[model samples]
Target: MGKIVFKRLVEVQILHDYFLTMGDGISFFQRNKKEKEELLTQRINRGLYSAGSIFKISPITANKLRDNKILFAETSSGFILGVEVDEVIEAGELRFKPVHDISKKLDLSFSLTTKLPFFKSFTNLELEKSLPSINYFTNKKATLLNENTVPAYTSMPLTKTAPAHQAGETYEMGTILDFGGTIREANQRTDGNDPAHWEDIDDRRFVTRADKVLLPHNFKIKFKDYQLVTQLEVSLEDTGNNKIKKIVKNSAEPFKDISLNFSKIDENDKDSPNIPSGIYYLNLKINGATEIVYSILLDNDLYDYQNFGVVELGFEEVNSPYSLLDTQGFLKTKIEAGGQKVSHPIFEIRLKNRRSYWRYKKNTDFTPSEIAATSNHLEVAASNILVAKKPKALTETLLPFKNGTNLLLPTPKVAGIRVENEKIYSDIHINQSNGLLKI
Candidate 1:
């Protein structure tokens, strides 16, 4: 019952990749359109908000802490809290040596401290609060933490996909497993026989902007067959032939999960058609369970929709209600320039968190209080993805779009996120067309 050690990249050095397809995502969304649409309603709503293909990374060489291996100072994008440093410096070539305001707030102006010829130093691992939580660079520590280890879900493809500046931003499906969910394979029976148990989500990711949404309803599933969670269905993935055609049966949930107080997304359905952000997936069959598929990014970043618009901060799925403003369970808020085209994509989704709670440390049979009383229960058990909408105005072109609505956007009424701290704090809803949205 003991073998969880994971965290490895061994080497690093990539130095370039800043792609952004579709004529630069359509000239960065027609010069950040959304000044309230209108270019004749964006040429009569074409492709709702087209633009795809994304990449953004720049690392030349890093990782070299020798010993057993563990050097991560300026390159380790998200979630790898192997924490426990004592010597691993390079903070990008040292240079902050200013001291004097009673010291503690961080000081280093660097006139020439220690060894600053080309940079290289070690011994400072108390990680001042894991160095500002994340977006790492280890504070720019440069690199060092080598002990070489891996096995606990070692998918390190860059922490299992979605970085490189999110390869061009656009996501939404939120059942909480980030990198847009859907990477299962280790669950040899929830832990008994030791299979590195994995599966967890709190569901609540909002880059917000509504054209009518309300059908997802908080489904924190763990699956062992809670009625297959009502045979759950949601479908919307055709990602150019990835296949997943139909079955969104109007906000599904009926096969049976005994309605653990279900809500199907805060009341919405006014003629549906306003789901045009991007990235969505969630489908489950329910037999012996584990069919899995979950992802959601929905950034209403219509090219910076408007002043750092969809700036979400903290809370990705645990007891949602915004994870109680995340005292520290994962709190982030980014979007540097204007809401979607910003430099902070919520720190690219809080730098892709996973530092700890590696889904209850990849459960080997549960015992950290029964895997924290059942891996944070986020029961969705079954669902689907994607929904695009367009042609709902300019006097309608030919309504009836449904089998997966095309012409470029036509899929509203998907509302499925909740983070209650009560008196409902925070607000932001802008639908533009379609309708209904009560979050």
Candidate 2:
């Protein structure tokens, strides 16, 4: 397979005053010219060295350098000679003037091989002197010799500890890669990698599971009713530090139920408390005598009691002396009050096989509105016959029933009527006065 190559070409201008030679190396002027030439040469060499050093220490550059796939070159443009021309009128006579001079600027070009086509441009040679000096080899011996430091290898075999890279795995930017002593960062993420899809985080400054953090939680403890325990005491102690975060104590009259509540408190506002997620011990005392302890985990928000009341309904067949009735059913309903009282309750009965026979005229024997009209009649009949009363006080008005009890609902008067006919003609009409029908 062919190898990928990257090239960086840089060209900079150097002013004549910086590297011009005055005379040969013989007289005082000659010595000054030689010194100036030496200084200029040193500056140019340093600039080239700085540029190469910056790229050499790069992770990709170092890897390529190890494989002997890198190159560096520098070139200078030869002296450029040119002439300037101008039109002049000297002594009322038009004349053409020409002046010859050498350019006062020197062009220097530098080229370096890189693993990636990423480079910075320098407008002039002075800018190169401003580049910061970075010593990749920080060791005393390595710095003195102007050489890169190499790690000492051991005879022991190296073990592969890192897991193999899996497909679709993503890593976040600024992820550090430690190559024994040298460290580099994966700063670019132009590929299919995104920090949002990263699974694991090595930084402790970020929170991973926000829901697991401790927040304000409501708790309530109620003593059984009609018991000797009229007082209750509750306290929550942090298991890690044995610190008492919250405490509550309450008392009630004799034979009365006692309830104690505890929660995280914030003095400034009642929003949330600054609690840490951990295990806590909940201590409870009944009548300031009986003590009980329980362990609870407070990693998530919790509520002690149900918010909505529950209603349960049960149905059972009952014996009926009326032979015309197919079956008699009784409804047994129970309502359990929760944190709040329920003033109104709604009960719905659904027929699984109910179809739009009245609107669609599925039954040709019956009129289109027969089912709809009969439903209204049955509802009125049921309201008139069905009466709710307390089982103990049979004559009393309907009241809230907290416990399960049987309800007596009499059959409606319209239940025995046959709403559908066998084969009734559409034009048939009945004479109300004589009770005779014409078909």
TM-scores of all models? Answer: 0.18, 0.19
What's every prediction's RMSD, in angstroms?
26.3, 42.7
Give a tens-digit lDDT track for model 1, residues 34-111. 321243245325533211111122122222122223233333222121212222123322111111111122111101
Clashes per candidate (backbone, < 3 Å): 72, 0
> 91-165, model 2: which lDDT tens digit per residue?
443332222221112111111222212111110011111111111110011101111212311111011111222
| TM-score of model 1 vs. true structure | 0.18
Clashing pairs in 2: none
Predict model 2's lDDT versus the native: 0.25
Best by TM-score: 2
Q: Pick the candidate with the highest lDDT.
A: 2
Model 2 Cα shift for residue 118 (angstroms): 73
Model 1: how far is 276 from its true place, Å? 14
